[model samples]
Target: MAGMKKLLIALMMAVAAPTHAEVFAKGADIGWLPQMEATGYKFYDSDGKEEDCFRILKDHGINTIRLRTWVHPSNDRASGHNSKDETVAMALRAQRWGMRVMIDFHYSDSWADPQQQRKPAAWEGHDFPQLLDDVYNYTHEVMQALKQAGVTPEWVQVGNETRTGMIYPEGHTDNWPQLAQLINRGYDAIKAVSPSSKVVLHLDRGNDNAWFRTWFDNAQKYGAKYDVIGMSYYPFWLDGRPDYSESISDLGANLNDMAARYDKEVMVVEVGGVDTEPQNTYDMLLAVQRKVADVPGGKGLGVIYWEPQGARSWSHYELSAWGADGRPTKAMEAFRVKLGDK
Candidate 1:
């Protein structure tokens, strides 16, 4: 009968639907947290009561944590920790809190960004082939370590803010073929150890479509293997390059274009605002989230604030979202406002 046919079709449709919807990640890169705690930093909730940092983050609607891992970090206060073992421990702690994890591999002993991508001291004087092996081995070793710790990261960035390239002259963008090989090695190693982890290739300047186009076109030409395209958007660091209000639309357009053009998901892997201007920072955070959430087909994976808990008093970092009073600033309140909420 027609009624029986309708019931059958409805049941079939229900069965075919996805078991769970993909969550839009609201995340923070608290890579400095352990060091901050070790150095006597305390975190408090909005109620002015002392509380665990993770609990405070959870209450602020953060569902994901991004951790950066350096090859062999120094013991310097501002630039130490985040070694492989430390990263594994942090990932375990985050897992215990039921938070999703993203591992950012700097592939260097220290920071690797547009300004510099120095080879780890251990990797110096190595040939290109040996460098490739190093990348693969190091990536595999970390992924295996995380696996052994029973913490599987949902995403892994092979390199941090690798706009020009990574690992110095060898992997620099000038040599696209070699750079592609290095990228693929890291990507392969990550997949071999954790098959489900999505590999991200991160770059700075999320608003510059032309730069993204040029960079990714070369990536495609060289066949760089990656699952996601990550970007860092910091209008504050633009140095009067352009204000956030002027560039926000470009960011949204670039996110949509990257997803469509590359056939890959995109994420705002890092964003922050001036800690002193909490209201402006709050508004900027909300605007960045909106641009990301508007990516077509839900390809906008997330927006993660970098080092939000690294209070300026302790870290001397102006972009942090924590106040000198040891409580989250109003900038963090933006995360509590869901995308579609009034």
Candidate 2:
């Protein structure tokens, strides 16, 4: 009777576990692909043949593309350039390429990060309950649109790099219960529109295991339902150095620890390589791949490179590996390389 009861309890526990888990995602944020192509930014293959940006990334073994969506982004010339329409269009192209897609919701009119979590202009002056309704309706609308387009995302981040929280002081960590309520509402909306989509709770500083523990513990305490733990790992610039020799090792350890502690699939949702040291970028990416793939209990989802094609333009994001000829640098070899067991 005791053995039978134990088996029943184990089965019940298994049934209670979260069902969705993100698979290993070799991804890149090519949200700029449409805009770049629109501007005549022709990308070339490694064979020196002109091709579309999506095909080039496909050639490099990228299996997924991450795109960001802002709720009614403004054209105020402040770099808040993304829109839901662009993301939906990008998702269509990624689907055409047989690539999985992840949509990061900024939950703001513009960027929402650790330092700033600005509420959308439309949501301003709303009370907490009204704000929750706004998040739910907006999230549901985005997912519903994707569902209509037949390009529903495989993963949807509730907010982008939301370290402090999302949607300003109302949704910030200072108000944990409110933040949890907002995040939960977003989660409910995503599931309502597309049950297959896995929800991600994203934060910056992937190497900082301590911060992740505190934030997630508080989240669990407040009853936030999420599937994946997405983190940003920008070792080169984020750590105030060009050499990432020591940083990479610490990063790997942190990834492992986060997986073991949280029992949720972890992903480096945003990463980058420096222009000056593309080789270092390659090494760092390779290390991240191997490390994430080695997470305890096989809970690592994978890493996504942030804007690997932003080079040789007026934008001139220094971390991009793209060259003047509109092809990826040698550092992109990281995506193509094979990894052995760690």
Candidate 3:
């Protein structure tokens, strides 16, 4: 009977092994680090016992938390907002609760959207090489602080929505080599401090795979090395309202091709289906998740909702009175379908 049990265990192990262990057995590299600070989303213990939010996330199949960092936010005590300090607190909470984190450095005081990329106050007067050092030191300091607090991140993004370059004139890279170096400085700093942590180059416009190929290919030529490619997808914003099929298929095809082309995995870093009442965009969002899950190479690893709780008003830099109670809507429920055979 003992021998029979041993054989059974051996068979189970055999079934678990894959032909290409690097891609298959290694599992999906989807970094589901959603920006909780911006969304006004909160997690509380049952009976209102006041448990940590990260613990709640771990219970719900979430393994990562993504936090954004701003260099020097306004000293507005009235609103009680401080991106740099607040993010570190969130990181500490996640670490204590046994969750991983990914830090996104905007390198600016306020929001760094595709439209505007302002230079940080401290970096305003610095030259190009000095600016690179400043970037390195700032990133190094933040990562080191996390390390000292016993909250090393699993991943770090050099810049947020960096369709344009970072640091304006000094660190901006219209040319590939210049931009690649600026990005590389942040990457190098993270690796130097935490060797195992993965570095990501996040981009916007998830539906456009060709754009991804062109940009990333250029980065690669200049020796840009990143473990995962992070993307943001919002149909209403990117492809207008309610075009689920096109968006998902586009994401699926893009991810497969990107994984094969660059020999790296792809993740939908920021995604949210607008569930504005009377609008009811939940079902459409579910369809997007379904299509993404069916993509080839199993390249579509994870899709993080950019704050399902951002019901009516959840701005990036301001705290509004908008929020949600109980579990997420049907659109949020659709995420379970993509959890697949883990």
Candidate 4:
């Protein structure tokens, strides 16, 4: 009788435990959407009918929206309009559309990437210690504002494409300890406000395993706290302008290796192909999605197309998936097919 009762209890406990549903995130970094709309750019569906950009993105099967926030952004058409207020508003809009949000903190007034990670002008005179405070305070403030607005981001990136490190000389990779300190500060602030949000440490060159290994090895040594590893894969920007075919497999290997090596989740936070070549871009997107989904233990989080809705004519960016007709090209369709679908 005692043994039968114990088995029954165990079965009841198992039945009561919640099951974890695996959701493969289909994301689009439409950070430029607000600026594009503000400047009178309209988005159309495949049928040539004008529609709200969010609706069109949903139709393309985008379940997550990524937005970038800049400190003291200028009013310039191209270089501006990602201020904190703008970010919060966009997050709210995304939530209304039933989409998950990813907050990308550029820590700059403009673009922050591998080529340049300039410090915001407000923190120009701060010493290293003060810089750490700046990161924590700014991150906490943004997170608090989002929380107050009932917007909880699914993922928060502490810095953009920091292969060389962010905040210039102070937080540069040359100074690993200081960079790690800065990253931890941001991480702490984010967790304090939104404990459930996963913090991402992002870098460019998703296909370069050696670079990722070295960089992440140093990050580990310095005790940087991050929940996910984010990467940017842009074959169009490669030195020889290689086709996606040349580097896609390498990207897949790197994603798998990062998950297994680091024991953490991995995501292709940014990826794009030539906008003019929609069919090729479509094929590349499908391949990239497959590579990410193939990560063992389901640690492959998601793939986000950077600025897919930012039509080339408006942004003058060749990597966008939208065309001059204000409609998303066939490449956007790649997102419509989710993982595990036939």
Model 2 lDDT, residue 94, Cα:
89
**Candidate 1, position 129, lDDT:** 98
- For residues 100-180, what per-residue lDDT tens digits would candidate 2 score against the true structure? 899999998777788778898998899999999999999998898888899878899999988888888888899999999
Cα error, residue 87 of model 3, in Å, equals 2.0
Clashing pairs in 3: none
Q: Rate the local accuracy (lDDT) of all candidates.
A: 0.94, 0.84, 0.63, 0.93
How far out, in Å, is residue 317 in model 3? Answer: 11
Q: Taking the tens digit of each residue's C-alpha lDDT, what string does model 4 give over 115-198? A: 889999999999999999999999999999999999999999999999999999999999999999999999999999999999
Ranking by lDDT: 1, 4, 2, 3
Could you tell me how far off, in angstroms, the CA of residue 76 lies in candidate 4 after the best superposition? Answer: 0.6
Give stretches of model 3 more than 4 Å off: 1-60, 75-82, 277-299, 311-327
- Look at candidate 2 and give me any clashing residue pairs: 117-168
Candidate 3, residue 234: lDDT:
68
Error of model 4, residue 154, in angstroms: 0.5
Candidate 2: stretches off by over 4 Å: 1-23, 76-78
Q: Between 1 and 3, whose lDDT is larger?
A: 1
Candidate 1 lDDT at 43 equals 96
For every candidate, C-alpha RMSD to the true structure in Å: 3.5, 7.3, 5.5, 4.3
